[model samples]
Target: MKEFRAAVEAGDFEGLGELLAEDVVFRSPVAFKPYEGKPIVAAILRGVGRVFTEFRYVRELADADGGGSALVFETVVDGVSVNGIDLIRTNDAGLVSELTVMVRPLSGANALATAMSAQFDQIVAEASGASS
Candidate 1:
């Protein structure tokens, strides 16, 4: 969890990727379908790092059984202040296997959805351009 927090603080996508399992799943606040696999999850996380500003963790709680962790955070997205929580579950190998994100406030969620959609589009465009 320390490594995960450090990676998040540093906005290091590569470092975060290293901490995730190959079959990691990411549940988004806006998206209906949870993103599956490391590559897709990594891309979404990278986009989130870009979209969220003034992000800070408010609280962190580890399960007594050491099975998972919950982190509460606050951030600004598209000029809207938002509160969020990250529920992370790790596998036996200590690699993050699942991460669920929940955000609050309707306005903030809307703003975040817009921003993330744009980020994902940009990512797709860049990847396509690179492939071309």
Candidate 2:
């Protein structure tokens, strides 16, 4: 989680992509569909980099489930803070294969939720382009 957080907070998409399994899937409450594969993950991370000025991983709990982990973090957007958790599952090869993220703001959960949305279209567009 720390390594992944470092790459993400640094906006190192290239390096981040290298960390994912090709069949990776990222899920969130805001989106009905899982953000499938690396392209979609990159797009969402791109949008996250745009919305959050600062993102840091705080805590993590691991080795507790069917080969999965949970990561907690704080992100700052326009100076306000928000908390997020990523429930991630990895394949037997130890490569991350799935991620489910839940984010709540300290002072602006609703606004953050709205803003966090409105990016699915971009995600879809990126995924489409990648598949082409």
Candidate 3:
């Protein structure tokens, strides 16, 4: 989990690419859509980059299911500090197959929602271009 957290905080898509399944699925809190496949995975990160700057992790819990894990992160965006939780599942090869995220404080959810919505659009645009 630390490895994945490091890769995500550093925005290292290449390193992350090596740790995700080819048929991976990423689910964001906003829009309720899941991004599937590696290309879309990269796009997901690209979209997040636009909103978050100082993404420092704070607390982490070991795998809840005895294998899959939960991670907590604190990030600064637009000068607001937000905490987020991630539930991740891995494949037999230790590559991430599924991911789900939850952010704290329902009050600030709107901005996070807006940012994630833009991120989804950006990822879809990128995916469309790649597919074309």
Candidate 4:
């Protein structure tokens, strides 16, 4: 999880990609269906990097079983403050296998959704281009 935090804090998408499993699953706070695969998830996170401002992790909770970790963070989207958590589970190889994100407050969530929605096309295109 140290690697994940470091990569995110540094806004290093290539490094982030290196830490994810090939078949990693990503659960978005605003999306109903989870996105799969490293390329796509990396692309989505890239979009997030573009949308969020003043992002920082405030707290981190590690699972007793050494299986997962929850990272609590805060950021601004469209001038709205958003509080969120990233639930990350790793495989035996220490590569992120699943990532679930949750955010709070109606206004912040709506702002996040709206902002991300605007980037969907670019995200999909990047992901597809990477896979190709």
Candidate 5:
């Protein structure tokens, strides 16, 4: 969890991927569909890293069994202050298999959605161009 926090705090987007499992799943705060697989999940995480500013983790609680943890954080997006929680579940190997993010208030969630949509579009365009 320390490594994960360091990566996020430092905005090490590439390094974040190393913490996820190959079949990782991500549940976004505003998105209805859960993103599946490492590539898409990683892309969303990277997009979030780019979109949010002044991010700070306020609290973290790890399960007694060490299989899961929850981190509460604060950030600003498009000038809207947002409070969020990340619920992370890991496999026996300590690879994150599921990550669910919940953010508030409504204004911040909307701002995040708008920004992330643009980022996702750019990611798609870059991937498409690379394959061409």
Candidate 6:
């Protein structure tokens, strides 16, 4: 998960993409369905980059076998204070196979949902464009 942290901290979206499995799954805190596949997940991450401000990871808890991890983070969305955790799991190839995001405070989550909703079209476009 060191690579994941480095990529996020550096704001390196391409690097982040390289760390994902082709069939990676993303579970969002506000979404009902889990988004699957690398392209969509990468696009979602990019959309998140646009929505969140002052994002920073505060702590990390990893399995001793390096199979999974939980990264604690803090950020702000439209001035709403947000606390979150990124639950990541790796596949046999050592690339991220699954990522589940959990956020706290109803206000913060609502703010995030609203902000992401505004960019949903653009995110889908990017994912489709990337696939094409």
**RMSD to true structure for each model, in Å:** 2.3, 3.1, 2.7, 1.7, 2.1, 1.7
The worst-scoring run of ten residues by lDDT in candidate 4 lies at 123-132
Badly placed stretches (over 4 Å) of model 2 are 64-66, 105-107, 130-132
On residues 20-119, what C-alpha lDDT tens digit does candidate 4 reach at each position?
Answer: 9999999999999999999899889889998999999999999998889999999999999999999999999999999999999889999999999999
Summed over model 4, clashes come to 0
For all candidates in order, the CA lDDT equals 0.84, 0.72, 0.74, 0.93, 0.85, 0.92
Candidate 1 per-residue lDDT over residues 1-132, each given as its tens digit: 767877897778556878889899999999899888876676677778888999988899999988799999999998999999999999999999999999999999999999998888755543344311
Q: Which of the two candidates, 1 or 3, achieves a greater TM-score against the reference?
A: 1
Deviating ranges (above 4 Å) for candidate 4:
130-132
Colliding residue pairs in candidate 1: none
**Candidate 6, superposed: residue stretches over 4 Å from native:** 130-132
What TM-score, over all chains together, does every model reach?
Answer: 0.91, 0.77, 0.81, 0.95, 0.92, 0.95
Consecutive 10-residue window with the lowest summed lDDT within model 1? 123-132
Tens-place lDDT per residue, model 6, 14-43, is 568889999999999999999999989998
- Which candidate, 1 or 4, has the higher lDDT? 4
Question: Which ranges in model 1 have alpha carbons more than 4 Å from their true place?
Answer: 124-132
- Over 4 Å off, model 3: 64-66, 129-132
For residues 1-132, write the lDDT of model 2, one tens digit per residue.
556667876778557777788889988646677777887786776667667766777787987555787888887765678888888788887677888888775364554656767665775686667531
**Candidate 6 residue 107 C-alpha distance from true site, Å:** 0.5
